[model samples]
Target: MFVSRKSIWGHTGKVMALALTLALNGACGDDDDDEGGGDNKPGDSVKVTGKVTYDFVPAVYSTATRAGTLAFSQVTKKPVRGAVIQVRQGNTILSNATTDDQGNYEITYKVPSSGSLTIVALAKTTTPSIQVEDNTDGDAVWGVGTSLPSNAKTRDMHAGHGWTGGAYNAEQRFAAPFAILDSMYTAARAFMNVRPVQFPELKVNWSPNNVPGAGEKDDGNIGTSHFSPSDNEIYILGKDGVDTDEFDSHVIVHEWGHYFESNLSRSDSPGGPHGAGDVLDPRLSFGEGYGNALAAIILPESMYVDTVWSQRTGALAAFGFDAETAPSPSDDPEPGVFSESSVMRILYDLYDSGSNESAYDNVSFGLGTFYDVLTGPQKATDALTTLGSFVNGLKAQSGVNTSAVHALLAHYRVGAVTSDFGDGDTSLRAIYTPVASVPYNTNVTLTGGVEANKRQQNQYFVFTGTGRTMNISVSNLSEDVDVEVYRRGTVVAAGYLSGTSPESVTFSSQANTQYVLVVTGYKEADGVYGASVSITSP
Candidate 1:
């Protein structure tokens, strides 16, 4: 997994293999002139207005296909929404304004020089969104971008260049993509000691009130933000209010963490809504929890913050809450396979040398150790990748003592995690239904999806398969049930349906191998389902 430093640069091809998935199109309308012009007298300021759009080609990354292709014919003029813009002269700062709905900005600033003042639009400081008076002209959200110093010289004095480069760390509000790039830099900088793997130009798409796709309708009001591994694109919400995530450095880095995992390692996250405290699917627990930990690792700050801002009128330009608090693993009385908070705490503990307060966090494994396991045995294992799997892999390393790591996991009530599948946990007495194991050629009756076991309705069992064709079947007596068989964590076969008919699958399995069967509801009840297994040899 640890490629030679020189060969690591070639890893970008695998990272950018996917095409962009979303296609965004914006039609810029004619702008209305402001009535009150600036007072052009001596020492008086002039009103300046400009438009902001990305002057680059848009590429597509597809999640379904895990491929990326250039959308050469597609329009590239993407209007940045809710970005703060400012006007400055020399060392003196003037007025600031947020882009309006149409990516246009107007700021009134006093003249700085005596003869001619060269006013420059600095990205991200303080700003205000546009105003709508009657409804004569169409409304559009303003796009923000920071002009680099090299690009700053291209600004037109007379006509005023519509765009320029001026990216600064503090000016993330003006250039949201800069924050994402900065997050990548922070992550890459840490790995620079070993010469980190190279990555392609990650395509990022952002706008107000839009999902990943061009015309995909958002059912929920909460804006969607994600990084498509197949597409190699990080989609962000530039919308106003609680939906914005660009300025939230933690949120940006968290999404980028997924990109890193999918490229540099492997992530088996089933992909769903996973909160820090929620009892989640094991896959979701590790995926979301790992991301949360990476954000803190990259920033190394006391707290992780996710912010939401207002595009319209308000005293507060943006408001945010912390993503991480002090390590409180004991707060969650019932920590299980679903707790991302526990996963994050364990990961942070493994890598952190500074957090010496907690006995659980006494080990200082460092990020290199974390990276080694993630890219090595954790990835090679066929077992269900979870917190337990990560711990198991970490212990297998040469330098680390397995007992010390197990002590840390036990301190957090993670249980005696022996393997990746969490084989020894007995906490299911109050949570999940009792698991019933059936030998080959045996039948077992299982009930799932009952209201009492909503979160833990899925039933799991183990079957020993000799070197032969193994047939596993599930028949719903009165309810609909589905079945999935796993050799370790790899799904060998799965069936899902909505009827009472039996769903079955047969596949050739290895000799004396342990196979896991998972039975759950399809769309209806999984009540009183009968499951049977048969093995046929030549």
Candidate 2:
């Protein structure tokens, strides 16, 4: 009930009150000079925070990358400053920085050619501030690039001279639309019902100075700069940092596609990369093809822009691939660079072909569908299950215990090859016997018209460690055929006979090894069929 007045207290009383509040926030030290620590040593704990920015003009068609500074306040829920922040990409490391009292900061970092990257900031009172558990924020900071700008978090930005663009040209392009190379993950989570922690570190970075003829100051190691090795960080080669033409069409999408493929493969099988290929042969091609396809998928009505290169559609179009009527690139009489699918080229064909009419069914167009021959579900609803089917098939072929799939996934995944194939032992996927012996006088039928006895698919091989020479032949069949060698489902090799006239193949094999041969008919049937292999000790 007592009334309070606004009148000031005594000078001494007021001074005393001011000192108390200063000490509480550590804004002002005690009367003792020692309290300052000379402004060098760590001061009273201050809550630190920060926000990261990446910009690429999404509305435009050029390859200009720009960035902005996002202070802690902008982040809405800022992190505790005064602590260390680390960013990463896959297993690569990028940077470590500390936030100031205002809870804002920025640090330089390296960015990889292409792929999804993540950045992380950890706050802890102790020396080892960060550990396995990192920042939960996805759009925190990118050592390179990880997302595209949207109306929600994007702005027409200018960082410096020659860096004119918004947040959609470079890495920012993926930010708003798909979470920067996160299409598979989004689809996986919604459709597969799994929320496995797939990403670990973070990578963040960007550059706007890169233009066709305008030179840039920084071009990373091997003309390829990258940072954020940990799974938590991400990086983007600034538009000014690399050639927009090649980088955007060939490099960026290609590399990111690898990550998506790796992740999907991981979820599908216990084995990672190695298993993925064996289990999902089409997936590998499809995965790589998908990357190339993204350019078309995103633009839908545009072509790649490489200031200096030939302004033309992808190779798939020039070659005129026909999925329904023409033979696959595999069937090309004299295939050169046609062996591998240029994702860009393939995707362009997809767009030109239109959505309702997936040109994939035609072998002539080099357009094909993994789902059509996959014998499983499509990517939208059952990615995990669909991938598992691929893994199970590969595992069954590898002749290894299915339980060991996880261990294999870990093993090869750590190496250059990610052993995460859903398939078992890939050895059975195909066999390559350099040397073997069979009576060439009578051909083994590859057209599939003759039974095992009628064609003699099984043959004999005598091996010498030094590598032996051998040849094969098939009766009357005119078309060249492919054959896979196996050991209890382990693939020894998978290939076609380079020569056709005599219907024969020459090869060398490992010494003291017993090999089994399985013949596959050519894609098309030539009717007359017969074939056999022969191995001669050197």
Candidate maximizing TM-score:
1
lDDT, candidate 2, 1-538, per-residue tens: 1111111111122222222332333332122322322222122222212342222222122222211121112222222334344444444445666544343555444444454333333322122111111012212221222111111121111111112232223322212111222222222222223232233222222333323331322222112322222242223333332332212322243344344444332211111132111222232333433444443443332433222212352111111122112233232231111111332233343234434533231211211233122222322212222223333433333233444433332322211111222233232111122333433233343333322211122222212332455443333335445554443223445555454543344456655555544454442433645555443344
Q: Which 10 successive residues of model 1 have the least lDDT summed?
A: 17-26
* lDDT score of residue 144 within candidate 1: 26
Error of 1 at 442 (Å): 6.0
Residue range 372-453, candidate 1, lDDT tens digits:
8888877766555677678778888778866667766776677766665565555422222323333345455555543322
State candidate 1's TM-score. 0.59
Candidate-wise lDDT, in order: 0.50, 0.30
* Model 2 TM-score, all chains together: 0.31
TM-score list, all predictions: 0.59, 0.31
Report the number of backbone clashes for model 2: 132
